[model samples]
Target: MSESHQDKQHKARQQKVKQQVDARIANATEEKGLLLVITGNGKGKSTSGFGTVTRAVGHGQQCGVAQFIKGTWENGERNVLEKLGVEFHVMATGFTWETQDKQADTEAAQALWQECKRMLSDASLDLVLFDELTYMVTFGYIELAEVIDALNHRPAHQSVIITGRGAHRQLVELADTVSEVRNVKHAFDAGIKARKGIDW
Candidate 1:
């Protein structure tokens, strides 16, 4: 066969495969919820978590958010999500590095984790966002076993989203879908601060 003919045939075969995959996805049931983990050294882990929250709210699903290790300022995402009737819980102690106290950070993280636990068990909540929760496990602030237990015991139809850098391998393995956002470029490196509505 000529090279051009082979290329055309390959393209046609690829299109057929794509169509099959798309059809399968389109017909798939949306009722079965899954645990999702968004992790990596790159930015946007929390951003992705909030994006999922927005999607859930847009679908008229009740959502809950527990923010760990971030409480310095009023983030736009938090404001918008709260306005959408999302039950938001923030540590109010800021980042661990800024607190400069391991015990204090641990206590704060534990409190937030407690709230997350409650949300996980609430069947009425369709989605729960564990924003920056990986830090709790990474820093040994919250017990990994407890976290796993809560995840496993969550409402069957509840969709959970965990986001942060350096997520535990066990958590990633437990997740039904894992997405790692890689940082190709960031404005912070160029001395550009995080902007409202975009970075916050």
Candidate 2:
């Protein structure tokens, strides 16, 4: 084909794509907080959740974050977000495997859930990040029904992001936006330990 004809065809195809994208953007006009779930066995679940929290902070929106399984770690995201005056809480006991006590893990999870509820009830908070919370339900540390109820009853204008692996079926069903991050590769698979500031 001639160069001019190809250019015209390219322009036509691009115009069609632009129109479709414009229609999609125009059709989504409703304004409200979203219950977004980021789940899978990938490496970026918590990272993506924290990224959303940072975005909210960039917009001057209030954010609340509670790290369940990773409470004991020295985290870069927590350092910056807390420095910026975002409501952040961390558990000192760390992961359940480290603790190795089912009862204690359950108690700590309940306490964290109370903190999550406190943030959920706060209408002023624009976003809440429940970090590594999927394990709480999956491990039976907290009742799934309670979590569902709390999420369902959250303030109309308050957005929430739940990040962890193996999210409950009900949660996937309930979420307005559900993202499944598939695992393609990992540094751990190559025998490299998790690096600080990047992994945590």
Top candidate when judged by TM-score against the true structure: 2
Query: Tens digit of lDDT per residue, candidate 2, span 1-200?
Result: 56698899999999999999999999999998999999998889999999999999999999999889885668899889999989987766777888898888888889889999989999999999998899999999889999999988889999999999999999999999999999999999999998988887
lDDT to native, each model: 0.90, 0.91
Q: What TM-score does candidate 1 get on C-alpha atoms? A: 0.89
- Per residue, candidate 1 scores C-alpha lDDT tens digits across 143-182 of 9999999999998999999999888999999999999999
Best by lDDT: 2
- For every candidate, C-alpha RMSD to the true structure in Å: 3.3, 1.7
Model 2, runs deviating above 4 Å: 1-3
lDDT of 2 at 3: 69
Task: Please identify model 1 stretches exceeding 4 Å from their true place.
Answer: 1-11, 22-31
